[model samples]
Target: MTATLHTAPVTIPDTTDQRVVRRRLGPGHRIRFSFWFGPALALAIWSIGSATGLIKPAILSAPWDVVVAFQDQWVNHDLLGNIVASLQRSLVGLTLGVVTGAVLAVISGLSRFGESLIDGPIQIKRSVPTLAIIPLFIAWFGIGEEMKVITIALISLVPIYIHTHNGLRGIDGKYAELAETIGINHGEFIRHVVLPGALPGFLLGMRFAVTSSLLGLVVVEHYNAVAGIGYMITLAEQYGQTDVIVVGLVIYGIFGYCADSAVRFTGRRVLAWRQTLEG
Candidate 1:
């Protein structure tokens, strides 16, 4: 007689969802994919379409034509001057917006009295599109540099206030309790805990603020008497210089992307303890 042994097969329980397992690429890889590969592919397609006459060179200038236009404008026109003017306006408006927003956010976020006094009016103001006030602003400020700068500032203020106030108010109650138990003073608690906790939201607001600021500057420049890139774009439109207009648009796009990237980088560094959840 032979003895036979039977063994049971083991099953492994799955813990992770296979559907959610995405490719994990490094930072450099992501940058290359977005900045290098994406741009190269776009350029290739654009060039091919231009060469094949699929795209009209009149409406959309070839890449080389844009380059030539850029060189010509740089040499003959005040390209750098326009860039500096635009940058200065953006910076000034951004500064005003950030300062005003942060101050108002802190006031409304910290105290019930402040919130009661300030939040209602702000909420009302926010509901109305800032662009809708362009007519009023033009009448009040008269389409001058003041109007342009104020336009940018006003457009930027809403996002910063909304985000920062939300951030400050959204701090964990547990942290407040812990601070109370630890005998941390109000100022110290805000400095060490509340502000740090709210930093992500603040940075988010700044990102929105930067974008709004640029947009406002551009729109404001569309009005009378401007010496920025937007003014140059307006002039290009009048002269049928599509290539120059495209170059200006490209510059605006590049600047906005870079500014957003800078804000994201700063947030990552500042909020080192936080982990980004991939959806």
Candidate 2:
């Protein structure tokens, strides 16, 4: 009777057994969203302001106007040609700058005598703005693509050199000691260790250099250039076609973003181990 009168055991769920799903944003996810969202929001606000006439449409065309202009340029294939020309110059300049910088950085990193020979001259040259040398470039190379490419290369060289040199010198001392203990020759060590370690910085510098190169293209093409995005902008300016100028500006912005993203993607792939370690 007592057992029969006993109450059935309560079916209570354990608090610990309940799932506690975290809704918090992760650092990586947040960073990724912020990177894209910030620009997008700003652009949206700018477009809305222009469209509503709150901002001067003549000075800053509405987003729709730019889009239409872009479509017209695209349909005419004018944008495509300009983009290709600009890309060709940028790639050539970037290649030359990176190669020259890498050579100089390796020399400086590996030999004290080489460092002493080049470092001072590089520092002195770096102090003088490369933009100031555009005239010299024009005089020596003439007002052609060569002058543009050389100017861009010269402008790009300093950042890459500085970063590469710093990266090489910044290598962990332990690794240097280990390489020496393992009978690794300086050349072999540089190939296997120094270059890989310095690559991230080198790539970062290249990104900056490329950006500068794009900006310089405007100046470079400001002269006798007949085709290129910069040339298109110059034409637009001459005609006072704000819409076309805005389209050109948008193209440059997009191109710069793509270039920087390419560099960043390459760096991420090349420095996967470094990223993992940092994470």
Candidate 3:
């Protein structure tokens, strides 16, 4: 009789992400045209409601009326000029805020002395909303471009500081230990590890900061702004032009969407190595 050979059973490790499992499963494959589905549905509903006389222009303008309002602004108002003015203010404020916030984050994150000096004041400021500070800013700088830009900068910086500082501090200690073992210089180790480690937080903060910039712009423009989307909204409110108001709101929505999309796209490119859920 031949001896029978026994084989050991092999165990395969679970590679599935349980967090994803807990959520409702989507199509196993990505939907190429699905991005437009939600917006298209919403527009369809709005148009149907308007046509059926269920939704009135008093509550919400018809899509056609909004288009007409946009054309009116393009033809009559200095719409492009207002947009340019708004962009200049927002971009300038964003540049200043991002640069300052990153520098402060680096300083505070790397040093106990800096953290002790800087962190407390910033934390105090975090409790206050940008809207709450407009009066004080007006008192200090008057209702001018100076006040508006400064307000937007202040609004934008806090998130950047908080997130980037957290990111820098949250870097893996093992990497630092390894760097030390390799006898890498402090600057070189930082260049390779610290900045990269903090990039996710930085990108995340940038998304928020951009939104905050727009928010601050809205508040300031509503107050006494001579130009901007918010100014258009204010004018429309005074005139009871629901369609124009919708146009202003739509412009704002578009700005926010486009800005977020740009940041997300850039972040995906920059952090290509990251295996994120969205990625």
Candidate 4:
């Protein structure tokens, strides 16, 4: 006898619902892989190399030696003084470069006549390398702090101008049309739309400016009378003190990293309206 068996239809739970809930949680559950992994791995490799004598202390000092050198320099030498000097130069140059670039970008982006007047000269100057202009700068400003600061400012200017101008130009015409429809004044339009739209580009340019300022400072410091990180590096090289050199380089790296990080944090805060694809 065939019994009529009532079979219930199997209902499968949609996994997509689970996935959506997890995704909504952001990166809260995931480990900060990059934050820890890279440094940990690098330290492991470095420790192993140093311990095994795979890395020679003469040519490239061990990590411990570098630490000792840093301590020595901090205690004995004017390390903080050098750092302050470098910071002052970098900040001044970066500020000047950013201001100048922002002004030029606004002028050129807002008007065709301004573009005609400013763009050609800027483009020409941008083509010329910052280091190449060092000789010219030396001739004009001499080997003093003025030439060094100006060199950094000039070096930083090109990237800031290029990125900011591009950003300003890239804004949609529709937005401008909408602003006009609403009877928005030029100042209001710029304040509400243009500046916000171009902020990402300006931030990008600032990153370049930060790096360029440091590069300019390093190069300029090497040339003449100076009391900065670059001068410490120069002294280390003269004495063949690889550990001291490493210390100087490490300081520069830390400074650059901190500066870049600040800019990035600022971007994230300022651009909270935008959804970026980056994890």
RMSD of model 4 against the true structure = 5.2
- Where is model 1 more than 4 Å wrong at Cα? 1-41, 277-279
Candidate 3 vs candidate 4: the lDDT winner is 3
Clashing pairs in 2: none
**lDDT for each residue of candidate 2 in 1-279, tens digit (9 for 90 to 100):** 455666889998765444221212333322443447766988989978986889898678888888898898889757888889988987888788878987898899777999999889989988998889888888899999899998888878888899889888888999889998999997898789988998877987888887887877767878788889889988889889899998888878878887887787788777867634222
Clashes of 1: 0
Candidate 4: tens digits of C-alpha lDDT, residues 1-279:
898989999999889887556656765344544545766788789878999999878767889989999999999999999899888988898888889988998899778999999889999998888899899889999998899888888888888999999999999999999998999999999888998899999999989988888888878889884698999999989999999998888888778878987897788788877756432
Q: In model 3, which runs have C-alpha deviations exceeding 4 angstroms?
A: 1-30, 33-35
lDDT of each: 0.85, 0.82, 0.88, 0.86
TM-score of each: 0.85, 0.85, 0.88, 0.87
Per-prediction tally of clashes = 0, 0, 0, 0
User: Candidate 3 vs candidate 4: which has greater TM-score?
Assistant: 3
Question: Highest TM-score among the candidates is held by which one?
Answer: 3
Cα TM-score of candidate 3: 0.88
**Count of backbone collisions within predicted model 4:** 0
Residues forming the 10-long window of minimal summed lDDT in candidate 1 = 23-32
Candidate 2 has an lDDT of 0.82
